[model samples]
Target chain A: MSGAFEIYRRWLRDRRRSTIVWSVSIAAVSVVTAAFFSSLGQSLGENAESGSTTSSMLGLSDGIDPQTPTGFLWAANYSNQLPWLMMALAIALGTAAIAGDEADGTLEYVLSKPVTRSAIAMARAAGMVTILFISAIVNLVAVAITAPLFDLYDSVTITGADGSTSTASGLTFGQLVVGGLAAFAVALGSGAIAYLLGAASGRKGWAMGGASGFAVAGYVLYTLSNVTGDLEFLTWISPWRWFIDDAMMVNGLTWDILWPFALTVVAVVAGWQLFLRRDLQN
Target chain B: MTVIEAQGLTKKWGDFAAVDDLDLAVGEGECYAFLGRNGAGKSTTARMFLDFLRPTSGSVKVLGGSGADPEVRSRIGYLPGDLNLPPTMTGIEAVHYFGSIGHEPDTAKVQALMDRLGLTADRPFHQLSTGSRRKVGLVLAFMNDPDLLILDEPTSGLDPVLQDTFRDMVIEHKQRGATVWLTSHVMSDVDRVADRVGLIDQGKLAQQLSMDELRTKSTGNITLTFPDAPDVSSFDGVEGVSNVQVADRQLSIHVDGPVTAVLARAAELGAVDIQTEKNDLEDIFLDTYSHEAGR
Candidate 1:
């Protein structure tokens, strides 16, 4: 167990520079996006009322107002930029867990030590997850520091289904935390897929390409299903459905967020089994 | 006691056999040199001993245990043919990182090795030259003072000085009762240290012999300066004389063993000047391969 931890710590140290760069870059983008909320808040209702096709397609439908801090944060950051940034980080880190090191021939040396393949696998996965969590936490802390200044805490006016108007309270601290966890879960799922591909194939490019393709396909499938009722069943396969359709940040929480987390577990097991059984190719 | 043992070891990749059924053994404190050309399964065999590659069939035992066992691997020091280190890590960091994998390495020993190899401890791996990278590998492999050393082409990128240092280090370890198995294209390194040499060609063990046996296998040539161009066939049937040729006033006879019969024939030819040149290991190596290929 200590040997595995040692491997974990060494891998984290190896990825130190990359972790810092990705974390800071993602945090900076989140902070800058939060800065635009005040001005955008003023025209939020008009933009939705204008019946902009773009807003509807982006899940910014009438029910999701860009005026509130939660809605704006979700639309501007979490919905697109935040999840995409996290996915990019996850894929890069996940592919590197095995495929990258195998290609570089470093994994063989590491494995030559008095450590089991299972220990090394668990250690690498742990390191990758830690980095992903750090990036998510950076984005969350950046948003927390910048949210109040944009009047993101003020009560939000949410019109009901029967033309009744009501003000929903300001974005609560709990909601923001839950929202961050949801985003992290989504990234974790995507990264796990990449990790699985890398461990199974021992090819970095395959992992990167396969995971990225899965993300794009999930998005296209989910959005097209919304645009066409015929493909609605495909939404279950898209992680986007659990993230956006449930309106995790705005409407409080639901079981949808757990899907990605569950997928992450399954992927890890599958990857571990594949890695242990196969040869470490050069 | 045998420290290394393999029985019917075979490794195949689809239709291609990287290593065929082979049985080998290396006794404690013996220096066994594995010699083969490129793509000759030397590195593949080494990898199997470390469990980096699983065997298709058969078994290899190291230190009386399976190579796949961590306890067994902990006692072995391995240097791969292709040494790769993370570009971001300095030599100092690598020493610490790889050293922590098993029992702690002696700091003084590591520093001494670095000094002897002329490696820059603070330089990142990518900044180091090819020879310097090999130096780092040597330091890492020798750090733990392991019981068995499996080095593949250990002196490939080394300078002549470093190569000599490596040879001395191996000899010192052997003196201390460590078993050494290594592969190298530099026959001199083998000629100077190997107790036994195994020649592998096209995934099969072609020949296995001791250093003295290898020396004896070399063909010695006798050059005789005659008064005039003599008939080469005049000495053809002489014992141990072959490929006899006469050029100008000189007669050349190739002898595989004792030169007594050739010397007698030369005396009968009334040769004024006679010279005998012995073949080295390099000649024997080439001869073995060519002879195998011819079959």
Candidate 2:
């Protein structure tokens, strides 16, 4: 319907300035973070021993040296800062997609028109996705063009503690894109939870806080499970399990990356249905 | 044809019912004012008519169709009691955005409504005062020339002049065959626009009466003053007059309807002056609420 299209246009236009600022900020952080790689590489190489606590925190697998170009890139930005920032952005957008507007009374006024709630749901959901995509693209392109400046594409030769030297591959452009998608997937799935909570409750604080708590629980589950391995059973609920376990930036694309995407679909459908069934909040 | 109809419509949250078992029908080309005190389920009923809040039981139909129907809603204009748009959005932007959605508003009509209301359309919603915000809302609700207008406290924040303007706009809409359903505490608005007033007290319709019926019911008291102490007995047993009392040179009698017979008696007594107390809507509104609350 043309009405639905216009609603979507207005939704995005309302958030366009924030989206642009978020994208540019992420790019700036990415470039600035990458610029310090060489300066920190040697110390991290000497101190960040394989299988250490630092590796687990950086989301690196056992024996992946933090000083390697691919390892440092994954450990420093992709696995932590970038995904966390993007996920925060996604969660905010998703929560605002319904509950935020409802609380502010804009959604109720919009619903007063000839546009169906389903149309508003679909249009706002699409707007959230567009913001995520644009932010991810900007983040990926920022790292891609500037990775060379930071020597991230140069291979690293490491002398193991056993006195044997081995060559680890440099970070590739394809891996950078894969890592970006992986981060996007995690953010999308988390955002879906935020959207679901917001849509079902129509309370901005409830949705935003509940979604944040869920993300935190997932993060703790994934990180603690990796270190202990005894809590592996609970890690299934945490999206961080797939994201950090694969560390797509280091391991290349894996089947595990699809898990967040799948979770997103399920959460979004559930949210939309609940939204359709309930009363619009005042 | 009834432009809006509700049959035993009710809304309950858990055990508390906001609106209960209400049956009402507002005909086309009429202004129906839904009046109540705060938290009396006025806004809740309005929301149900717009389908923003679903009825817990029974049915509410607008324009002979479901309120949930987009086509039905297209012909409806709505303004909430507490109007809030995005803080960053200016009134002009709000009009453009909401207009772009469904039923693209006529630009000339929009300008006319804005000009008439004296709304500062370029100011963001947050920058405007309460009355200014209400002016923007009035323009939007009237801009579409909708078949039905559901306004909740439409003149709450409006100044006296703008309140009059809003009443005029509502009258114009009614003259054009557009039905109006509004809730207001402002008696002037009720007096100017409402053809019929439905007093909803604690989610129930306590009374429904037309403006003429209300005026007829307003016959509170007629005080006859004379140069000398008037004969209270003379006014007794007069038609449509009761509670006759004499104090000094005045005879005060309560008249429920016409005072022709009572006045004739007073004329015969050569009453020098006369005073009539016409009860306004506030008394009736308070009576309805207190009556229902005491019950």
Candidate 3:
């Protein structure tokens, strides 16, 4: 096998157990969230159609109609909740890919090979990205399967705020899949950031702690920047804000996506370069 | 034809010099043993050879390529002094992983080596005993059939039978015209297999000698029991003999060279029976190190 593929294979074999666990957990969360939103949307739709006063269906301030598919509710809620779940999973898996090997002394054996050190880092990062992609797909599938149950239970047509109405049968599965995949790209970017931190630190605890703290810190800074508008420069430094703004799951792609994607590339490349240049402890 | 050449190799950690001004050459098809005490820079030298540890000064060239170059690294097999195998991997997996790194070994070659070395593929590395783990390491080192082999304390945890088997493996590699450089404090191990030995003391090469030359330099001992009280004092001044002790008709003399002259002298003194023995490698090694330290 080529060196790149060999490294990728090794990474996959090493992380097979963790990857399975992450996929299952993410899929479970997606299922549970999909179920909860479907029931909530149905109850609110019944209240709206019966001419009784109730909160707007799907938790929106706008009115609900009986014609639209329940898939819209699933997509809206998933787009809001899934990013955090995906971020946590990506960080956990990416942290282990590089730092775990260093802690276990396998780094020496791997680096002793004929392949360059940079290739090792790049291949491992690629493996983590692959894992993130798999988890995202599982999450999307869960949402797609569970969202239609809400439409059956509510007996209501889902309508957009502009008074346009569509039945559950009218929903485009392809659009939902594309939208889900775009959000997954954000998870991939987060995985790269986590991998960079892991390689730089060479300690799993430190890498995980630092990545989590960075994510939380970035979120807080982005919120503050949004509230104060004048500190807009701070949003550029926050990966979470950049990912959310770029994927535009709530609305659509924004201009801010460009900076975060660029930063993600820089972080990943820097991490790989550090791993190549530093002497392996083992 | 030098297979490994290290010139003015110096490695220092902060103010401490781990390896200092070292120059070594190992010829093709030769088994060269590096002998040193614990913390005497033997492992440091080995690491520098593989470019695992960067030298503070100087260079190491393997097969005419720089030590750090992938081309050179692929042609050399190294068994690190501290054998740290990944606990999660099986013995076979570990070998396969290294084999992938150093030009993948053919399945037939790996199978043959595992069988010869008595390594089981089913056992996880953490489950293996120390001797078994060493066998795992041995398989990795020899499986690739590289042009140069650098082994550190290669026989530390082996049983006598396995050690003998390992000696045969080294010989087999030599027969294939590969150069082997191994480091060990066990003198007899070098005596059994090494063609030439380099003795290092305190981060410096104190002496380099062939096995035959080493045997010649160290004095041998002879114990003689005279049939009668034949005044063995007459044999004391003879050349090639010293440290003569005579008590109750038993005479012991330290012989430095061939005993032909000493035996003839003993015959003249009416010796009835005499036995001669050579000094062991351990004693010779200790004496050599002590003598060098004293100098």
DockQ of each: 0.67, 0.80, 0.32
RMSD vs true structure, all candidates? 2.6, 1.7, 6.0
DockQ of 3: 0.32
Q: Which lDDT tens digits does candidate 2 get at residues B67-176?
A: 88999988998989999888888988888888887767888888889999988799888999999999888888888899999999999887888888888899889999
Number of clashing pairs per prediction, in order: 0, 0, 7
How closely does chain A match the true chain A in each prediction, as TM-score? Answer: 0.92, 0.94, 0.74
Off by over 4 Å in 2: A45-47, A50-52, B291-295
User: Highest DockQ, which number?
Assistant: 2
Error of 1 at B165 (Å): 1.2
Candidate 3 runs further than 4 Å off: A38-81, A151-187, A197-206, A223-235, A244-247, A258-260, B82-104, B220-222, B227-248, B251-268, B271-278, B284-295
Task: Please give the range of 10 consecutive residues that has the lowest summed lDDT in model 2 chain B.
Answer: B286-295
TM-score of 3: 0.80
Candidate of highest TM-score: 2
lDDT of 2 by residue, A1-282 (tens): 888888888888889899999999988888888888888866665655545456666886765566788777778888888889998999999899999999888899888888898999888888899999999999889888998998889887877779899997788888888888998999998888899999998999988998889888889877777777877898888888888877877777888887877887887888899998899887
Q: Interface RMSD of every candidate?
A: 1.1, 1.1, 2.1
Candidate 1 chain A: 10-residue stretch with minimal lDDT: A53-62
